[model samples]
Target chain A: MQAKRVTFPNKVLPYLLLAPQLAVTAVFFLWPAGEALLGALYAEDAFGLSRQFVGLENFAALARDPAYLEAVGVTFLFSGAVAGLSLALGLLLALAAEKAGRLAGLYRTLLIWPYAVAPAVAAILFWFMFDPNVGVAARALRGLGVTWNHFLDGRQALLLVVLAAAWKQVSYNLLFFYAGLRAIPRPLIEAAALDGAGPVRRFTAIVFPLLAPTTVFLVVVNVTYAFFDTFGIIHATTGGGPGRATTTLVYKVFKDGFEGLDLGSSSAQSVVLLAIVAALTVLQFRHIERKVQY
Target chain B: MARRDGMVERDGALTLAAHGVLILGVAVMVLPVYLAFVASTHPGADFLGGRIGVLPGPDGPANYAALVGLGAPPPGVPPIGPMLWNSFVMALGIAVGKIAISLLSAFAVSYFRFPFRVTAFWLIFITLMLPVEVRILPTYKVVADLALLNTPGGLILPLIASATATFLFRQVFMTIPDEMTEAARMDGAGPMRFFWHILLPLSRTNIAALFVILFIYGWNQYLWPLMVTTEASHATIVTSIQRLAATANQEAPVWHLVMGTAILALLPPVAVILAMQRLFVDGLTETEK
Candidate 1:
């Protein structure tokens, strides 16, 4: 909130400067959010002609709905897999690149381009590779006597989505992890090396511990990504199919609201998603504040 | 000398292992796209049965030409050419719009004191909590009411108020020494003039860096464009690929054309990130921090 010690002495100009951003935010963001909050409390008839005040009934119904509960579970599983897979791969790759010395830059460039691929595009890339009929990866799996149809198998579909989501995310995680690795003081590793520690030992005792903050931050970020951003991934690849196995909360909100036209339930889900994001944003900022202090 | 030689001998193996890991890592990252590119070169019939080829086929130019000119198997799907243009316009609009508004707001917040300034800042800050996906329906209704649906303005405006970019500019502005402001004031450089000359020039790198990140963010946007722009004329390449894939799922899979479309859809953003590698890295690490 701090301002310059010397000031620009124009009240009207400052307001004018802030107007466009404020106007867009008010109309597109605040108003819609306000409507979602209010709509969560009311229900409309199937004809969209009559409305009745429901007073927490919608939220209560979501709490009892088996499908909603299943979605919550699925979201946790999906995000956990995404975060864990990407973080581990990122760290491993970062560590290797650090030691690869001269080849590091080339590897970084080659590896990081996937960060530019959209989640939906990433899904299709993998979807093509895993196509049941003629995909190279699917063919390889079949050669190994493993059935690999993401179309009919719920677990296979979930795995496909997870791989797609994690593949796109690994580049992001690697950048952070590589940066974190570079930030570690080199002499600390040299001193440890002088004391006769192996590579794995040195990583566990020094490199991994120093990178903990970066890892923590990426966990929150990757989870939020898997939750919200992968809506495109799920939509494009599976459409939450194989009997809703790949449907996360965000996908369900889209399905119920836009597709099914269950405004009340969708709005209730929106409120829930909003609360989750707010909490995650707060956690991210707090972590950032702590990182700033360090 | 003997101990150093022994150390070198041990380190040599470790370094080789490191190179091994990095090669594998890069291969894992790049293979899917490579496979996709190879598939795009083959005729669609090649993927009808049997295993897909690992190498590029003879049909690359024809497949790409057809996609560029005529689009894919889905009868009504927009051509890759127009969708790419729409994607470009939407991405450029979002990036430029966000940067312009954010710079102005950050300049106001950082350089001036006004009533409700804190309130204005928080109002923008609250947007970080409500992504478009969370408030999909009501936001859709607002656009529909405005009759902005299926328009470029509809695609760009609703998404352009960026709290992250605003905060990034504010952070950049805070680092400017107060004496610079005082010097500009003493020279009678009015606020806007000083902003145009001094502040703007000084923040060029930051601006470029932010542009890289925001450009990618805008280009990669899927769910918003998918929901807002129903008409194929306004459809972005990203969403169009999804539509194409969906149709391919139902009918004979047009793997060649679909892969070609996917490659085209991803190329611009990937090219941006690679070309602006340094700025992209700085923008990402700094903004995230």
Candidate 2:
């Protein structure tokens, strides 16, 4: 909220400066959000003839809907797996890179560029490797006696999407973890080292504890990422499934709205997503404030 | 000296372990793309039920030539050229547009005190909570109502209002000493003049960093583009890859061309990130913070 001490003393100029952003936000963001809130309360009849005001009916239906419940479960599982896998790998790589000496820069460069790869593109890359027929990884798996057809197996489909999603995310998490690691004071690690603690012990005792804020921040980020951003990955690779196995909440919203034409239900789902995102954004900002204090 | 030598030996062993882990990590990171690249170089028939080789094949030039020049071998899949151009334009538009609006808004909020300034800031800040995914139907409706569907404006305009960039600029502006503004005023440098001459140069690094991040964001957009552009002409490379892959999935499975498209789709953003890595990192951390 801090502003410059000196005033510009030009009210008209300030409004002019703010106009474009405000106009865009109003049109693209605020209006649509308002419509979503209103639309969630009304049910449109078949053939788009008339709409009925259905108070909380859409939300009630979602709560009881088995498919929606399944999506909720899938989302949690997918997000948890992606976050856990990516965070652990990111931390491990960051720790190793810290000790890599001259090779650290090269390793960082190689590891981080994947951050720029689109989630959908990342899904494609992994899909090629994990395709049921003629896939190298699938062949290797089949050779090991594990059936790896994501097309038929629901769990395998989920796993494939998870891998694709997590693979793309690891680089982002690594960059943050590496920056967090670099910010940790060196002497603290050296002091722990002088006390005869090995690298593993030092990491568990000192380094890991200090990286807690970063880890927490990344957990929220990674979860939010897996929730919202991985829509592309799921859409491109599995198309939400071997049945509805890979159907996430966001994907379901898209399916129900665009494909199913369940406008009321989709709007209700949008409201739900909006609430979830608002909560996450608030949590993120609070953590950012805490991080600043640290 | 003997104890020091022993410590040195231990450190060397640890460093070796570190190198081992980093090498494995790098391999895991690069393997998929390498495999994809290798797959792209092979003849389409090679993937018709056999183990895929790890090495690049002789068909690299032919596959890429067909992909880049003739589009996918499939009947409906559009050429890579137009899709790539669409992606480039959309990405550049989003990045430049977001930065332009955000820079001005942040400047207004930080440098001037006017009525409804707080209201304006909050309005923009609220956008952080309402991602396009959340309000997909209605946002699509708005764009459609505006008749922006399948146009560059449809792709870029809806996405250009950025709260993160605005906040980042505000954060940057806060660090600028008040004296700079005071001195500018004394020299009669108007608000716009001061912004162009002083603030713009001072924030050049932030802008570049932001541009890198936003360009990637814009290029990688999937759902928005998928919803907005039903036309192949306006289809971005990222969204088009999905369509191509879906088509291949149903038919004879042209793995070579699909992989080729994937490589082309990812190449520009990856190159930008690698080329301006430091800026990207700084932009990422600063914006998130």
Per-prediction TM-score to the true structure, in the order listed: 0.97, 0.97
TM-score (chain B) for candidate 2 is 0.94
True contacts kept of 1: 0.84
Query: What's the distance in Å from true for residue B228, model 1?
Result: 1.1
Task: Please compute DockQ, using alpha carbons, for every candidate against the native two-chain complex.
Answer: 0.64, 0.64
lDDT of 2: 0.90
Candidate 2 residue spans exceeding 4 A from truth:
B1-10, B70-76
Please write out the lDDT profile of model 1 over residues B69-168, one tens digit for every residue: 8544334445788889999999999999999999999999999999999999999999999999999999999999999999989999999998998999
RMSD values, in order shown = 2.2, 2.2
Q: What is the interface RMSD of candidate 2, in Å?
A: 3.1
Could you tell me how far off, in angstroms, the CA of residue A257 lies in candidate 2 after the best superposition? Answer: 0.4
In the range A1-294, model 2's lDDT, one tens digit per residue, is 767788698869998898899999999999999999999999997467899999999999999999999999999999999999999999888888877766788899999988899999999888888887878998899999998999899999999999988888888888899899888876777677778888779878988999999998999999999999999999998999989999999999999999999999999999999999999999999999898786
Clashes of 1: 0
